[model samples]
Target chain A: DAGVTQSPTHLIKTRGQQVTLRCSPISGHKSVSWYQQVLGQGPQFIFQYYEKEERGRGNFPDRFSARQFPNYSSELNVNALLLGDSALYLCASSLSTGEGYTFGSGTRLTVV
Target chain B: ELKVEQNPLFLSMQEGKNYTIYCNYSTTSDRLYWYRQDPGKSLESLFVLLSNGAVKQEGRLMASLDTKARLSTLHITAAVHDLSATYFCAVSWATSYGKLTFGQGTILTVHP
Candidate 1:
């Protein structure tokens, strides 16, 4: 079975631009969550969606947003990107609560 | 807010040596996960520990969780250069099904 898959292995955008990163959860998985990992730092929780509903959100600014589709795929959108926005955006999927998670290779975003 | 911390953020040891990485969380969590990441790569799930006194082992890595103390440890035995990578521990609470707060990550370098 395929694990969680993220799109556009890498991306580059300038400040104040908008970007959208996509993720396809593993088959049979229903929950999707997003995280941001900066250089030399661990990933920070961004948003989590289960059953197409926003379950929780991190401390990120309003410019960052995400949504899940009926098929369990997810998309993370960042508007007005800043240099700090350059980071690896990871997508994780799980079967149920506390059931462990499978992560994607992540989309490396570079905001110049 | 949930806070996850890892001690000895950087560890350098010789091959065939044994070492342990520690993870501590501030909030109550019954589920803890360990993940490994190579340079310029995505996270690979290593272990998922649930409940107190839970222990799991794979290859040269052994992980144990203690819910009462909110601590988890990953021990590497007979380490090799292949084990050189960053290890992260994530904690999940009941309220959020699949949302995880990750630790700072321990970068391990095994020398020959």
Candidate 2:
């Protein structure tokens, strides 16, 4: 079975610009979560959606937002991008809230 | 706030050596996860430790969790060049749904 998949393997944006990264969870998965991984660091949680409802949010600023579709696909939106926003955006999916997660290939965003 | 910390942020070891990566969390969690990520790639799930004293292994990699101590460890046995990558540990509290706090990754370089 195909694992979680993300779109636009790479992206480039300028300061103050906005970008949206998309993810499609594995088949039959009901939970999706987003994470940001900067160079030389671990991924930081951004948001999580389960059953089309917002379940948790991370320490990210309001400029970052996300939503899940009825089919369990997800989108992570970042506004007013800063150079610091350049990182690999990862999407993970799982069977349920407390289960092990499967991650996507991630979209590498480069903010100029 | 929940936090996960990893030790030996970077490790370079000779092939066939054994090493352990440690992960500690600030609060009790129901599940701990170990993931491997190659440079410029997405994450691959390695092990999922679900309860206190839980231990799981795959090939030459093994992971164990100590919930009471809020600690987890990923042990590499006879490391190989193919194991060169970054290892991350994440934790999710019982009430959390798809929200994971990740430790700063430990970059492992296995030299042949």
Using DockQ as the measure, which candidate wins?
Answer: 2
Which ranges of candidate 1 are over 4 A from the true structure?
Answer: none
Assess the local accuracy of residue B66 in candidate 1 as a C-alpha lDDT between 0 and 100.
87
Q: In model 1, what lDDT does residue A5 have?
A: 95
Candidate 2: residue pairs that collide: none
Whole-model lDDT, candidate 2? 0.92
Model 2: per-residue lDDT, tens digit, A19-107? 99999999999999999999988888899999999999988999999999888899999999999999999999999888889999999
Give per-residue CA lDDT, model 1, range A25-61, as digits (tens). Answer: 9999888999999999999989989889898998999
For residue A82, model 1's alpha carbon misses the true position, in angstroms, by 0.6
Clashing pairs in 1: none
